[model samples]
Target: MNNYNTIVIGGGPAGLACAVKLHKNNVSCLIIEREQYLGGILKQCIHDGFGLQRFKEKLSGPEYAERFVNEVFELNIPFIVNAFVVSIEKKDGYTINVSTVEGIKTYTCENLVLATGCRERTSKQVEIHGSRPKGVYTAGAVQHLVNVDGVIPCKKCVILGSGDIGLIMARRLTLEGVKVEAVYEIMPNPSGLKRNIYQCLVDYDIPLYLSHTVKRTIGYPNLEAVEVMEVDEKLKPIEGTEKIIECDCLIVSVGLIPENELAGRIGVLSDARAKGARCDLDFETNVEHVYTCGNATHVNDLVDYVSESGEVVADAIRDRNDSERKLIDIEVKGRCAYLVPEMIDVNKKNNKRVMYFRSNKILKNATVTMKVDDKEILRRVYANLRPPEMERIVVDYPELSENSKVVFEIEEAK
Candidate 1:
């Protein structure tokens, strides 16, 4: 088709859920996915623990994704698989040029949803001085190799980041008859969830070395070992704490960066904190009809939140107002790492304003407060707050003018 009411440029869980919701709203939407399949990264995630929030069941990643994929299929939503979006232009509405099996095809849409997801941090990005070798791979790449291709990449591996993927891979490699020596993290705190650390490392009897980092990779054509070092609180390496661990493979799962290159092409303002598009409560970017959701918005820890973001964007597009978007910044003060929907559109009287935020550091008995013009409107006390676990909040914020100051503050209890 040459046109659609909305075009979602990803066939992952976010795009799939977005299309399903859009279809339910009687909106004609089309999905374009670069991968041959619709499941995105979930395809390689074979372990369970997904869908706890959304489905209320412990389902595997594929299972969670399959639910939405089936809905899209049953709803008869239009989708093009293995289609890469070559370029996007905002001529009349939005023009999307996609490269498909048939040929280059052009499609137009009134609204565009970017669900391109996130990319893993590589060895080079983390400044791991190493020679290019076959054994070094990202956690996601190792996942695909083992799960999809049924090929075990290595016999002995040392994971260089206690990220969720690295922790999970530590256990996964063990199950696949590979020896996982240890997981090293540069930060004092684990980068992943507490459950992941317990289930993947603690339960698996794998040790996690905190405040430690891989200093150098001692590998040649294939692989060999890595030199590790301990770091101080400021993350500066301690001189004499260096040690070398022998392992055939090095799995790098330091972190993920949101895929916002497409958003950048359309003059969308970027948020350095969120590492994505600067969006309002409705998930709409500065550019009128362009929207961003899922990991394209930020690296969400759970798949459920990714799907939730998609639904939010779908509903926003359905109930869009013609009134000018009077956007006001939701200033973050103290302890908050970042907050999604950093701005709120006062003109849109959407009672249910959903937001996601994370703590800058671990805090016990933390108090989170929302205020407008120094008038505290909402305040909630959390018994414990951790940086890895993201907190979601829904507020029916009071009506405000364009100049009203909206701020969210977090403070540790005395």
Candidate 2:
């Protein structure tokens, strides 16, 4: 049995960032990753446009993740690669079961940080009714095939959903002599960042069909074509609007959901919208000292935010004391899709909150107001709002008592 002060489960941007921060703070921690190497999904994402916020310069995913991985190596942070955490039981502290090459091992830690990241939504999740064909691939898998494996998954493909991965793959496949028939989006608006829409889709002259979906896939041992159709507001296909597009492959990049099986093992509460653990301001989930960050908390558009969330969890763990936490729930309303950190721990000295939110529908000239006990704390304004682009803001407010209620509402500018 190996014991440590803290256990960080994951070695991607989030997990690596937490280990780096903990090492810098002279804290004893162990990083456990299931993969053979560190730098999770980033190792395969060869495209640029990462680290724009954190580094203030454009970098590839590998380059961005490399910075943190290097820091972990330089500090000689203790980590186990190819280590799968099989079980977690919270006793006096936490007893974690691991399955490594050396066989079963149990590790004990006072605190656990889950930066498990997220999993991409697949064809079945989107209900793509079709035979399991060889030509169907997820955007991430196709990216790995082309960038890392030196093989192209498809020569001519039709991409479903305009998320960043799908958008980037559209350009990548096109550049590799693959013809992208068009991008089909069920929602009225594209789900990816606006910049990707221009640089990846419009720049390549690839067509984008909004309020549309892949009605059916035509393939057998391989994908022959796909039936695209317009969808109504409820996202159901319209009658007689079906059209066939000949393509060898169909790439799906609908969305991502947080991976929280380990958290579930600990009986941690989850937020419905966030699709991950519901954490407080200190990044501490309802499971006491157990913390969560990165995409395991919520799917973030930028990897920079993922790294930041990890660092936040590191600080939270280091300063964790026996003080009682009094939490106040935050109310979301007025067309807001969802808000991270659903509640505030008013008992803690930390008052600065980094909030991330998105609107339920598109809004122009919108205003977001935050108040505690009907007392205004902060107000932010935006010229344009879209569901694809999440809004992040730092809000500092007066410390409150246990009964003080916090509310966040979005509204059109009067």
TM-score of 1: 0.98
Q: What is the C-alpha lDDT of each candidate?
A: 0.91, 0.89
| Model 2 error, position 382 (Å) | 0.7
Candidate 2: residue pairs that collide: none
Give candidate 2 misplaced runs (Cα > 4 Å): none
> What lDDT tens digits, residue by residue, belong to model 2 across residues 284-331?
998888999898998888899899889988888888888887877788
Best by TM-score: 1
How far in Å is the alpha carbon of 37 misplaced in model 2?
1.4
Top-scoring candidate (lDDT): 1
For residues 1-414, could you state the per-residue lDDT of candidate 1 as single tens digits? 689999999988888889999999999999999999998889999999999998899999899999999898888999999899989999899999999989999999999999999999899888788787779999999999999999998999999998899888899999989999999999989999999999999998999999999998997898899999999988988999989899999999989998888889989988889898889988999889999999999889899999999999999999986888878888999899999988888898857688899999899999999898999987999999998999999877888888899899889888
What RMSD does each model have against the real structure? 1.0, 1.3
lDDT minimum window of 10 residues, candidate 2: 343-352
- Could you tell me the lDDT of residue 293 within candidate 1? 91
